[model samples]
Target: MKPGALALVTGANRGIGLETARQLAQRGAVVLLGSRDAVRGEAAARSLDPDGARILPVALDVTDTRSVAALAKRLERDHGRLDVLVNNAGVFVGATAADTTAEVTRDILAVNVVGAVAVMHAMLPLLRRSSAPRVVNVSSTTASFGLTSSGADLAGDASVRLAYTASKAALNMLTVQYDRAFRQDPDLAHIKINSASPGWTATGMNGFRAPRTVREGARAVVTLATLPDEGPSGGFFDEHGQLVW
Candidate 1:
């Protein structure tokens, strides 16, 4: 058996997701890089972990059901179960993207919201078999009600992209609902599920203009992914600590 747990991270070909995968692998987990492009996935996996500590490249397009199911089956056969799942894939309909048509909105939601749910559904059984199962959602601070409220801090910030924010807000609720469901069931309550904000980082999503390095932004995700069995669930946190929902 491996000395540490096993983990899978979606959208790990670059940016925060790749950095998080790297950090998790460094911590001893057998990390799988889930990417849409097989070549990019394998390349990223190698770049982050040249010596290969248990890291593998799994060709995964979260929006594709068959691919998701196939990855689940492969993991079941290879690892028996998955210990961690990081829902890090997201789409940011930027400032100019506000003019996006309903079709565009649906497309974004398909990958960011529906696709994530599908992956979660597919991975649940494998996770159930693990003693310490964890689902860490890579969310954004813009999803915070506290931040978006009119009188609260960061209100009126033009950086808030409507379509993207709404998608993530819905995702946060999804996290809460899943946590409640897990808690209600004795067999699954042991699973820790939480949403985390990676903060503003220089990634392709933001055009790599943000100040924080990918390493700095990936910390909260790595922390939540490797949480102790007793760690909090259904909470939202940033790098410093928990955030006000």
Candidate 2:
């Protein structure tokens, strides 16, 4: 990552988001830890960097357009441009497809799909100011149809999370669309957009049942967020390499 780069990670109060922010800070980027709750966000930021050296807590509720706009405005005022954005804020509500309802699906989409798009739209102007900007959408392997249908162990178990899986699949498409649109535009070609799967981390979203640690889950996100100008875009990747989209 570039020194003094300005980065933002949403839902950074805990779990993979928090770890991503920490890693970015360690790489010399001034990271904005975004959370829906101001207090928790501040606390999380302090925990990562007690001296307030690299982390700044910001109240950002991606689902709310007003909140998203407010954060954009603040970023423009405080920092001329944003170099990286990690759309890590997501929710997994329903346990199984059999028990999932329309409302639950809507709620999941609102945060995982719609909310992520909102944040990206609002942050585009700021990102445009940077020489090289990157966006990493925290996706999941559960979104992969190839794996799900291949009778893989993880996919077989994730099949029960209908709402989460569908939402992430939508997010993956959103990443592709954004990358395509940016690449087609001469002025925006430098912007890289990609989706990442953290490989079933033990986060609150999963009741802490997942075996992977937060650091392990955050590696892929940080890698995409800090990609070079020539890095691949419109791709779904994990820590190892590109994943089957």
Using lDDT as the measure, the top candidate is 2
**Which whole-number lDDT from 0 to 100 does residue 3 have in model 1?**
45
Per-residue lDDT of candidate 2, residues 1-245 (tens digit): 68999999999999999999999999999999999999999999999899898999999999999999999999899887999999999988856767888888989899999999999999999999999899999999988888878876772256468888899999999998998899888878889999999998998877788889999999999999999877999999999999987
**What C-alpha lDDT, on a 0 to 100 scale, does residue 144 get in candidate 1?**
89
- Write down the worst ten-residue block by lDDT for model 1: 151-160
Residue 17, candidate 1: Cα error in Å is 0.4
What's the true lDDT of residue 52 in model 1?
72
Clashes of each: 0, 0
TM-score of predicted structure 1: 0.94
**TM-scores for candidates 1 onward, in order:** 0.94, 0.97
Tens digits of per-residue lDDT, candidate 1, 1-245, equal: 13478899999999999999988988889999999999999999999778776678889999999999999999889889889999998887664454756876787788888988999999999999988898998888888888678445542244547778778888899999999999999878889999998888888987787888999999999999989877899999998999877
- Model 2, residue 197: C-alpha shift (Å): 0.7
What lDDT does each candidate get?
0.87, 0.92
